[model samples]
Target: MTPYDAAHSQGSNVLTDGFGRTVTYLRVSVTDRCDLRCVYCMSEHMTFLPKAEVLTLEELDRIASAFVGLGVKKLRITGGEPLVRKNVMGFIEGLSRHLRSGALQELTLTTNGTQLEQFARPLAEAGVRRINVSLDTLKPELFRRLTRGGEIARVLAGIDAAQAAGLKVKINAVALKDDNAAELPELIRWAHGRGLAVTLIETMPMGEIDADRTDQYLSLSALRAELESFWTLRELPLTTGGPARYVEVAETGGQLGFITPLSHNFCEACNRVRLTCTGTLHTCLGREDAADLRAVLRGGGSASDLVDAIRMAVDTKPKGHDFHIERTLPPAVARHMSTTGG
Candidate 1:
């Protein structure tokens, strides 16, 4: 029997937090390194975790398996850029077993789309049907300015490659007031024209970046009202299991989603947790409390011991996160979104 099956046989496979939220989604950060440093995500001069500090691929798989054993149905591999990690495809292929065995419902990743041109076909072959690509703007200069030095052409080509590979692509754009606010209408129309779903996220106050987050933060509620002027947005009663709420666009017959953590709190139904590259389990993205799964793993703990650690961590999951954006205050959480597997 598989580890998950063995755990299930023991009858201790459910993971429920203190608020009675049954945790079902796990986002794992394979690495803290990235090819491009976005202004909103990282500091101008960022310091990454040491190689020895990050968990190995095998360790990641083992922990993820334990989570699956504990009723985690969806797993999303994230990173500063997950594909940039060496031999990550093999790691993803290894996890495909749970998908085949019906223990896991979905296996996907959120990428910057720079590496999609090369990894798209392999990803589809590994059973990843849908992926979230981060694209804020289509303008070459603005894209370059946002991602520091990333080429917009490469990202577009990567998106094209992903579509050709039969992978359903969803665009995730961070709503920035001074940056992409005016361009959002064009961006949404472009994505809908291509038969792709787009999710607009408010700029979160997560880490200490060169730019002030207060200046960048845009409320999705306000944005939605503005979109209603040009396009007919009908609220859809659908959820993909994350915090985003969906709406259908009448003109394009496509879907548009909003992830508003700042303007509107989404923690009431929070059923997700983040696992950092260093094996830290963050019960909530907006909170600093975490459990050290790496310590449990490296200390020669047994399978049951690891499971117990996860359960103990879930037991302490906060009812909701404390996320606020004010110029006078620091980040809600000192860690960057990249570190916590955005």
Candidate 2:
């Protein structure tokens, strides 16, 4: 039987997976469409999910509530670009109500920061705690080239707006070996100068990237060695629930994070799962194992049915992701990151 605390028997729901890790974070992708088509994230011939197939705001809320009941505390709203969805601010407002009602501990979002100029203040007022913005390059030309026509100035404006709204901002940059490896120092200086933290991620072997995966993949250890050559890196605490290891950079007074999915895997402490825009529950990012919640939800299933589905998924959770083992191999994940809520 799946591990479960007797309902309200202990005054809280504790849902533990097969690995004995308690899940607290849930990532929900609101839309599969994005404004910027970064070369690493999507292919040129990608076809997004139809509007009719995407989950409605009401349906999303119901799903979130059920997860909360199953012991999910922190909720992150993601997307190809979450802010690109229509009336998404209203949906955030509704989720904020849930936070106020004590159904959720924290509400956060991950965006491209292009729409933050208009949505930042509203998001703050709606009870969002923080946001992670995808910014692969600092140079205007490089940013445009990387995102297939994104303006770095506009993203900077959006970041400024988010800061003004009192929203904690973090810059998530994917380190491409030949592309942005040398620019790491500059990116760190730029982010820390503005009181924002920057996280460097290794390029995952998912989707059709612009460059060769093996050639483009840069290990965090290698990046750290380069950073240490210039500045001293002091280890810091891991307060956040994510996989990124934290470090404080000397001289610059900035914090740097490395998400070494390929170098030093953090799957032994994995405590999160993903919900796709179409209501598919992905138990693991590196594996294609998923539970189709859309079928249950659309088939006139009750909240109890949804709970059962979640319980079964947790029971059968894989040992861990095989990203490290499949480094040089073909992509094991059939679905693109956009569809998987990355």
Candidate 3:
């Protein structure tokens, strides 16, 4: 078996989980509130979480610093809709200052890109290196039907603005049944022509999104098989055994990636942990989380205490996900992808 040297290791075993998965990536969810009412995340009668229940700016900073101190080298800021949150720029700027020495090598974000045009430039200036835009359809009518905002044009413009501001742009598409699945090649061509990295993600069966129909998720292996017919794929030397099936196209500009949790399970080599908007630290995406950082923060725990908590969380990583065993996750926890910081 191959081993990870943890190029970004801090000489401390605090970051490696029980299975020896050194956790260097941290996904921080800024808010659980999103304006869109997509069928996947929201039901018709869905209600947003209260503002008071969310983490404060100080809390967020403390948690982020704690993770950074514990050897997390990469962080991605996400949200239900981060742009909607007030003082987001200030928040990013604060994170930038704390990570001034560049110990945090990469800090980026994933957004619906609805408000990217307006905020893209400022975000780039505030130390965000990359931007991942979630776009499922090229047709405006279908975009509106699938996404609550119904604004495909704006998202397209946002991509342009982000690229103009010198941020590495990646197009993130969630292939859904009877929708954009058939259009993968077209999207790949478009992204390559525009010098954008393209990532196809499988539908995560969690919470409200899972309550209905999760059986429709297509596996990454199948997606790759379909792509190989059109493009000559050469392997790239990325972290091996990763969830994202990454390959370089012979003629395509940027590489192609697939995030597969169902058809190809990657929990055995999972090397990341997520901190939700509410300050809960989730060890894995497909399992019920047993540890949380919220209690420590609220209980006046020190940064050292936070570090110990993180180490303990890593020590308890599940043996593996139960996709093959047909084990179901807890219903209450699966309701919101935003809650998982995916």
lDDT (Cα atoms) of all candidates against the true structure? 0.92, 0.83, 0.74
**lDDT winner:** 1
lDDT per residue as tens, model 1, 158-237: 99999999999999999999999999999999999998999999988899999898998899999999999989999999
List TM-scores for all candidates, in order. 0.97, 0.94, 0.89
lDDT of 1: 0.92
Candidate 1 residue spans exceeding 4 A from truth: 1-10
Q: Candidate 2, TM-score vs. the true structure?
A: 0.94
> Could you tell me the C-alpha RMSD of candidate 3 in Å?
5.5
List residue ranges in candidate 2 displaced over 4 A.
1-12, 324-328
Clashes of 3: 4
Query: What is every candidate's alpha-carbon RMSD to the true fold?
Result: 1.6, 3.8, 5.5
Candidate 3 lowest-lDDT run of ten:
1-10
Task: Kindly list the per-residue Cα lDDT of model 3 for residues 1-342, writing each as its tens digit.
Answer: 111122322346348777777888888888877666566655645667788778876787777766776677777888877787887777787777635676677778888888899999899888887878888778888888777556788889999999899999878888675677787788888888999978887776666642344444566677788788877998877752236767788877578887876677777767777788788888877777767688888898855677788788878977676443133643435547866665
> Global CA lDDT of candidate 3, please?
0.74
The lDDT ranking, best first, is: 1, 2, 3
lDDT for predicted candidate 2 compared with the true structure? 0.83
> What shift in Å separates residue 214 of candidate 2 from its native position after superposition?
1.9
Q: Arrange candidates by TM-score, highest first: which order?
A: 1, 2, 3
